[model samples]
Target: MGSAFPRLHVITDARPGRDALGVVTAAVSAAIGYQTPDALAVQVRVEDDVTDRAAYEFGLAVARICRPAGVMFLVNDRLDVAVAVDADGAHVGADDLPVPAARAVLGPAAVLGATCREPVSARAAVAAGATYLGVGPAFRTSTKAGLPEPLGAAGVAAVAEAVGSAPVIAIGGVSVDEVGELRARGAYGVAVVGALAVAADPEATTTALLKALA
Candidate 1:
């Protein structure tokens, strides 16, 4: 992916189990992992509800394969596994541990993300010290069951406005088709799951998204 900011995060889901999602993760990592330092930020996600083993595998795979400067492990409701693996970062939602608590566990160097479905939450996340705001359901995403209603392009703009200077990452259901809208709306980046995860070629999918965003 030829992202201008060189940032592209790929979150994985266990909702479809290993065979389907695993292949995507592997391909995304291999595809964009070798770009020069200033050209890409690749993250491999291990989203699990109970079994932490998948998270562990995802973290190691990211380190070994993606070899990215950072890897954000989406801790749907757990942070311990993310810490144990020393993942590059952690993305937590409002229902999970608060930002301050996550920061404490993650330490200063570890990036902490907050999922802000609305502007109010986006403001609060910035006030609480989120490294970045995950604002989305830019479309309807089934990767995370019971996800908040679609944010659409307008929702993204609203969150970006609330964040002030903090960077905003549009996530949830975003696809290559919507990159231009996301950028025009002022999202610093985008986080994708199903689009790239279930693709026939993960690397190509990831690259295509980056190109679109650029």
Candidate 2:
């Protein structure tokens, strides 16, 4: 109904080696090569085994590029890491720290996003304090390995209904062909990982995804 955040979260397609400092930086640099920073939200999930110090260092490197483009750094499940690196925001999941706790950690102005698989999850997220809600795995995909069962358009609608005034992002196995249908279903934006990250031309791939959204 009113202005909220825009869509376009491009998940990092690769995982950094457990202890390799260069791994995260290289992966992010490659992503920068794929798409303009501000044009897309770059969501990174630093492996659990990595130390907060390492994650912070990696985020700093990412910010060097992302901050320039006005691109948002969406750290998954690491509120402190986001704060430490001055990230644009933090995206958490149902299983992670609840939205209220995350928001409290980030302060009121910080962006906080939560993953919602069903209507209930969506409602709880907003009630707790998420600035936005991420809903899906709209279709099956390998990127989110071992995620919950897929929630197609129907699930998307349920989340949207719960969102009411908040923006909702549809993530998971979305492809070029599905963009129109997904957007038509009320998704405020789309998130992808392997689809664009694995493509031969990331720039072209990103152009196509943006076009799909339009």
Candidate 3:
């Protein structure tokens, strides 16, 4: 990737019964062990029904883990909690605040991310001060429902071409097997939930994801 943005984004899985913190612990540990901590970003994404307090607590835990390991930490769809926990940044989707508004909330130096699917939205988001673009549902996913159809490698290429140097992180249904093609198609990175969360060995999976991106 041309930018400093991490190539592997390990999104938190906060669904009921999911051990989001445990998964993060393992992933972060793996990143440090590989001496490539900066190549990984951990994004905390809690369910909508969860309380703000709960989100804050989770963000705090993740921050502690990431900060010491020198890994980037971000919160999804919750700027307030991100600020409260002093996260590295936040990611906003269509339903959340616009990219400009999110930039205002996070301030000029924060690493802001905006989710977009096409060239138009991608261009607008970068113009509005997004540090990177999360462009996908790159493939079908069971983690988050009601997402638009998966944007295959070609779709990622379209947004990447439009944005020039801004890093495009291909999200949703991403896995080790798909990372190479996504990168070949112009995706700067890939974001995942189940790929690591449900894996038999999260640390190993994290390493594998990083290797694939390489």
Candidate 4:
């Protein structure tokens, strides 16, 4: 899982007239075609209103799509669903299970991602067994409401430096254009949502992102 960190992380979201699974599948398919399957990972994150059963079903479908391709599939904030679907891991935020509790549930073999906005929390999360830290909004984001201010490159670097070897995934409103700066600032990788979801050409966008990461 540590080796899997710092790769491109594509988070899925269901939007009007758009198929979340379709977008994720397309992006992952394109990514694997462009690079090694390990070069990309997908996190299945639907609306909060969607039921646990629905989430589990979605996770299963995504896992099926990703596993065969060698891409890691994770469920956002749903440990139960992740386990039920045999997902590679789970991503938990501040309001979700504490890092220790999450690690306890997923065990050492599974990947556990914790969200952090600053250095102190970053260190704490790593201490609690978080495999990686999602630190952001690296830029202004409209995907999630009530997010704190963006943690520009310097903020991301501070957290990365604080956590030492733990990978820092710059999340929130990330774009392909910011990849170089983030890599230069010590960010291990990025987690993107709206960028690929709304892109006119998702496969092309996925290729561009992978190229930047390369």
> What is the total number of backbone clashes in candidate 1?
1
Compare the candidates by TM-score and give the number of the best one: 3
Better of 2 and 3 by TM-score: 3
Give lDDT tens digits, candidate 1, residues 1-214.
Answer: 2323335666655454445345545544544455433334445444445467766665565555444433333443457867776665677876789998988888887677888888887888778778888888889987777776898999899989877778888988888888888889888888877886678777677777767755
Comparison by TM-score, 1 against 4, better one? 4
What are the per-residue Cα lDDT tens digits for candidate 3 across 1-214? 1236699999999898888899999999888888788899999999899999999998998898889888999999999999999988999999999998999999998999999999999999999999999999999999888989988999999999999999999998998999999999999999999998899999999988888887
lDDT of 4: 0.87
lDDT (Cα, tens digit) per residue for candidate 4, span 1-214: 2255537899987656767888888887787688667778899887788899888888888887888787888888989998999888999999999999999999899989999999998899999899989999999989888889898999999999999989889998898999999999998888899889889888888888888988
Runs of candidate 3 with Cα error greater than 4 angstroms are: 1-3
How does each model score on TM-score? 0.83, 0.85, 0.97, 0.96
TM-score of 4: 0.96
Better of 3 and 4 by lDDT: 3
Clashing pairs for predicted structure model 4, backbone only:
none
- Tell me the lDDT of model 2 at 44: 67
In the order shown, what is each candidate's alpha-carbon RMSD?
3.4, 4.1, 1.7, 1.5
- On lDDT, the candidate that comes out on top is 3
Q: Give the range where candidate 4 is weakest over 10 consecutive residues by summed lDDT.
A: 1-10
* Stretches of model 4 off by over 4 angstroms after superposition: 1-6
Q: What are the lDDT figures for the candidates, one per model?
A: 0.68, 0.73, 0.92, 0.87
